[model samples]
Target: MIERDEAAIYVDGLTKTFGSGKNAVTAVEDVSFAVAPGEVIGLLGPNGAGKTTLLKSILGLVLPDEGEVRIQGSDVYDRPQQAYEHVDAMLEGARNDYWRLTVQENLRYFAAIHGQNPAVVADRHKSLLERLDLDKKADTAVRDLSRGMKQKVSLASVLAGDVSVVFLDEPTLGLDVESSLKLQQELVRLTEERGLTLVLSSHNMDVIEEICDRVVIMSGGHIVANDTVEALIADFERQGYRITVRDIDDVVLADLRERFRMTSIEQTNRKTRFEIAADSATFYRLTDVMEHHEIDIDSIETVQPDLAEAFVELTKSSESSMKPNTIEKGDGD
Candidate 1:
């Protein structure tokens, strides 16, 4: 076995089951992957898709029913301390500091407890405060900060440690678009300037599409797809069209629905508009059907493919291939 120290994190055949008998539910099933040094890996999946459990197993926070997980050349299950010292995690709803502490105090305090030098901690505190846009309220107690601001503080504290890897779960939740972009920019800077490796799990497709070097998508407790975002998008092109028509009465609307995949229908006083999805052949068929029925044509426009559509398609595909299964609610994701 090659010790993949060159990789920041590695896993093979990782699985987690919650119970025995008919009530047993597997949260993660036979997941395997590796994160290269300094790479940003996005863990993507819909609700109850096993993404969260996989992350916990990799982080050594959950004991796997079966499999191997290694962090920075150390076996996480065998040498917990050594495996975790180089890692920082910001799981959603987790507190990295006391409520009584101020933003500056939290950073300085956590750093010191981690055995970081006081001088280095001070330097990190100043730099992070400015970069994360928390400088103005550095002295304010964390309990007083808004939810979004507190999340920023949590992310900022991760850097206070001398770790090479960071795990962030829904880092953008509760944030406005402006603050979300700020945090995203900071994440990019960390990877670019400091060669930090990040394992990010989020439902925000925009953040995943923009920041991740590679994506791992899960469904039914299994990894349905794993590849670079660009490749995945290119391979699975979305098929969509928006069309306007004249005199779309119930008969015509029913016919259209029966023949094609109509996502939405909007009817103006005289004209009707529909957003439909189809392959090239079906798209042409739709136009021909309209012409044959003598329905007046207005215009048609193409809808470009994006990550959200790709995610939906992949999950659907995974669901179709799997056997009947029921994952436990809340615990599955």
Candidate 2:
């Protein structure tokens, strides 16, 4: 568990290269970030973008060639036991728990591994099962349960040891919408109630936007943007509006095109519709232009950007910023 004043997880200049020489592929390069206690950090990346390698390296499942990872103020590579004491992960929810065990049994069995007294953790086990909506399946064998139910049982087992940090890798994959929503709600509630830090890796933008305090977007094995969901959207957000005006003459249209960023123009018998990017300053400028032109005003509306747009733009920017490498044979592994 993390003590006061220290980040829950700290990664510094973490670089990992696979293979050797010309065939070597850099999964993660000079990536560094610190996650505070109780913070849910999202890993956003496309395929082959190094998100998995980074997470595994921090968790000690993959060793880094250079750089360091610290957990709870202890260097994970040098003091692994101390650093990993309170870290638990459910990378493959389907395989994390025993197939023959019931939900309650799985939780009890896992908690026992941490030397937690059955009597002491009994109440917590019940609470976890109920909160995860798995109480009804408490007595049901994991093998007999559906995939979602088994995943919930696996999650309960992983968290039953009172770990301070949780890593969930695509926890909602392949689940139905209702099941996914239920799991998401349970995750948020349990993490807040337990004050646990979480690192979530998923392709679901809605889940990331809803749960993560901040997102670290990666592309080409590099961090493109690391900020809160709101801030990221505000930074890369597309701003625009469509205006429908009556008797928008050729001269007025000409002035608008010359003055603003406009697209999607359409004109009917009496009304003209056109789209343009407008901010408060631009809106004021547009009103001034219309007044000067003696043109009748219709309606103007703004379009807000969604998380998907921000993700695309951020990833694209990262891709554009990549520097090509020239391979040279060296005497290093």
Candidate 3:
């Protein structure tokens, strides 16, 4: 576990509820987590799962009914100015950039507001523009640029200042495939090269799986799972496997479906392919049943569970009991 003092961002027992009486709704409930310095943590949840509330609470946009939030050991509420001195955010895929100003000017303005001398960080700003493929648009007014270009400008603006911690909500919301990939790569590089602590929220699981050191999944106003991406996927019990076989009939298919959780059954040119989710014991039993049915197994391979699958399973499980379970990263490293 990371010590509270050492964490770049820390939240403890944070709870927030909207309204009052029976009409009231609890958005976040007793949520606690920490992000280590230079770590990229992904925050994921479905709509109305309290993700926005949690982020807003952490950013001090929304006051919580309970718990404390600290940034680099400075109490957020007690020392708001000090705690947020080296922090910035690109919320909802946009930053508050001056539309009338040129792209470079907006970056300079953001840097200046953050107590950074634009001239001093001019090289950094230039690199940001170049890396995001916005160098050509540097002199163009933000209002004249397209939506995708604006999104890139927003990200560059967030990194323009001398900040250590950044919170990005839907960073890739309006980006093209190439732009999104570029942004993801740059984010990873910036985190490694500059030790920038990032808390990214995106529905794109691929982005989360690719870059995040750990993921915090929220459901029903609670942290349902907090663990490294690999750990979360591995911890999921039902492993998926794709099997291709020949000499299989409807009776065999029906039996397989009855015995195990089956899906994606496809048949082509006398060959049958299907997928199943099962444990080791159940898998072996499935093989036995296939053998008894005289099925010729052409091939079989494990369908590795990715972050998206794990997210679904975790959120679904939390529906039954909204208990928080914090899974620490494994010691394998």
Candidate 4:
């Protein structure tokens, strides 16, 4: 874990609530996390899990009721200007860019707002355009570009200045597979070349698994899990398996269902197929049960767990165990 003083972004015991009394909804509660310089952090949660609220609070868009945020060791509340001087965000994906401005003009406009002279960062802008495959459309108005192109333009505009920290929400919402792959590559390159710190939120688990150095999962306005993608998956002890067997009767099926978690059961003539999630010992117990019943095991295949599976299991477990809070319906996420 990065120390608060050395972190590129630090959020300490932050909490935010909406409305009052019984109608109040707690968006974030005592959440604390730090991002190291040049590290790519993935923020994941179901809708209404307070991901947007947390991001807004960090960016000073929504004032928190308690706690504090800092950027590069500068307090955001006490030194707003200094703290945010090196920060940029591409929230709302393509909508973050101005429709009236040409692509290059948008970059210049964003850079100028960040206290950067466009001429001084001209090479940087050019490199961004070339790397994102937007060089040809640099002179075209954003409104006239395709959706994928527009999304890339939004990202480029965010990195137009000499900023070191960035927040991106659904950065690849409307892109083709090739375009998404290209954008991912460029983002990794920029992080390596410029030491950029990124906080990205997306429903695309594949993207997160491929790019993120660490993942922070939130459920019910609380941080439930934080770790590397590989670690998270490895820590999930329940292994999934697809098994096919023969001569299994209803009594055996009922016994299996009662004894283990099973799903996707299909039966055809003398053969039966089912999927199950269990630990290694439990799996051995299952095999023993089958042997006792004289069931013939036709096939067994291990299903490897990935980030999506880990996210589902973690969030589901968290949601199930969470006590109900006074959260109003239709409040900000």
Candidate 5:
């Protein structure tokens, strides 16, 4: 593989399982991938698909049964503290804050630990609070803030350390539309302006599609697919085109039937409507047939599946293929 200067995280052959006997649940299996700097990679999967487990293992909160994980060229398991020196994470519940401390106090506390002096920390805190629109609430106790406000506080902790890479698990969970949009906008700004590499795990496909440059879909203890959102859409061409035509003669109708596999065909008094999944080549063939028959197209529309629908189809397909068949035990014979 060609080496890149911007790789922030590299994980290989990582595997983890819980339990010793028949109850053992394999969370991750031989997962390997790398994340580049300023790239927001979405770790997408349904619940119980090891996204959280994978994040915890990388953060050293849980030990992997096998495989290697590195952050910025340093092995997390071997270097431990040093590997995490330039890394920070914000998972569910935003547990990094002190409920008793005011927002400013919490920011100051984290900044001091990150080796910043009080004055410098305060300055940075002020700037971040202003940017995040939390300046007005800086003196409010963390315990009194709403879920969305605390999410901002959690993000503040990640920013306080000025880490190169940050991990956020379900960052927008339970947030209103306005708050979610703000968080996504801020994340994009951080990536574009500050070169922050982020690994975000969320069930929200829209969030992933909007904010992430690339996505890795995991299912049943494995990575089923990994690529850019555009590439994935183009690869499958899941969205079909719906075409309606003026009354077709016998020859034109026969031509269409022979040339393409029509997914749906409906005949009306004045027109014929059909939906089909065809690639560029197939579409060209379709056009040739239409031209030869001199058929008049009444209307045509391209339908694109939403990310949530795409994710469901992709992940569920993988899970179905991975399911093992049960074998019944024979009784006394």
Candidate 6:
């Protein structure tokens, strides 16, 4: 049996590499992090960054070549079933119900398998359907529900059971705006009211930032950033500013180019736009120079790179810096 702890999920030194020698692919490498009970963690990465592999490893769906995954306190690989007793997972397109079964029938079926009384399961099925806005479709066949409705039914199937830890892999993938918003709100409710430990993997940064308390970023099979949203954003905040001026003269433009890494500059008939990096003192010096030259300044929109942009920039830099030899090397035992 696993010991209960404040943290609901913990993965340490987890690694997974498929094949060997020439054909080997390192899917995930030395990934480690913790999700406290009642917390939501967003596993964010680009395509082929090992997000799905990490989730699969945690779910015991895929055996890792190295390291360990723990749900609550039980080692997932060691205890297997027992370790995941409290966990419930929804892969991208897993449909639990028999297609011929009605939504109500499906829930009843799963609850029965979970050892719940038929009457209680029936009540739960009704309640979940109502809560998820699936009440009208409860008697409809599983195969007939819309994609959004099917996703809801699948989620309800998991929530109806006694499981406390939920793993959602791109739960809102391809969902329309209204449906996605509803699901996102429900996910937040699960953590806030039900104290559910939710680990979500998605390519959507907005979704991740909206729901997750912490974020773990993966790139090239390695965990590049793991921290709270605020901390991660602050990590990249290195005194950047946007400057808008009434005009872009050669002297002013030359001065700016010489002082900082100017990411962008836009010149129009009435104004110029610039995204530049500079410290506080440097900002003051810049303004002082503009004033000395009788330059009229317009409004500025100082923008900082958000989590999505930061993640992209960091991973691209890391990927570009990898040596050819390293890329050529295979993942081996």
What is the C-alpha local distance difference test score of each model?
Answer: 0.84, 0.81, 0.87, 0.89, 0.79, 0.77
Model 1 Cα lDDT, one tens digit per residue, 1-333:
224776789888988988789778888888888889888989998788887788888887789999999888889999989888878888876676677998888888767766787576687689889988999999999999999889888888878777788999999989999989988898898889889999999999999998899998988888888888988887666577889888776898899898887878999888898987678888889889988888888898988777777788899888888655546357534
Candidate 5 segments exceeding 4 Å error: 1-6, 241-301, 324-333
Backbone clash numbers for all candidates listed: 0, 0, 0, 0, 0, 0
Indicate which candidate wins on TM-score.
1
Which 10 residues in a row give candidate 3 its minimum summed lDDT? 324-333
lDDT of 4 by residue, 81-133 (tens): 99999999988622788999999999999999999999999998998899889
Q: Report the alpha-carbon TM-score of model 2 versus the true structure.
A: 0.77
Clashing pairs in 3: none
Our model 1 lands, by Cα RMSD against the true structure, at 2.2
Name the best candidate (by lDDT). 4
Evaluate residue 216 in candidate 5 and report its C-alpha lDDT on the 0 to 100 scale.
Answer: 88
lDDT of predicted model 5: 0.79
Stretches of candidate 2 above 4 Å error?
1-5, 92-94, 240-301, 323-333
Over the stretch 201-296, how does candidate 6's per-residue lDDT look in tens digits? 877788888888888887777778888887887777766778788866888678868876676788878788887656678778888877887887
Error of 5 at 53 (Å): 0.7
Q: Which runs in model 3 stand beyond 4 Å of their true positions? A: 93-95, 237-239, 244-259, 262-273, 288-299, 322-333
lDDT of 4 at 54: 88
The residue pairs in collision within model 2 are none
What TM-score would you give candidate 4 relative to the actual structure? 0.88
Stretches > 4 Å off in candidate 1: 1-3, 263-272
Identify the runs in model 4 with alpha carbons over 4 angstroms from their true place: 244-258, 262-274, 288-298, 326-333
lDDT of 5 at 1: 22
How would you order the candidates by lDDT, starting with the best?
Answer: 4, 3, 1, 2, 5, 6
**Model 6 CA lDDT for position 98:** 79
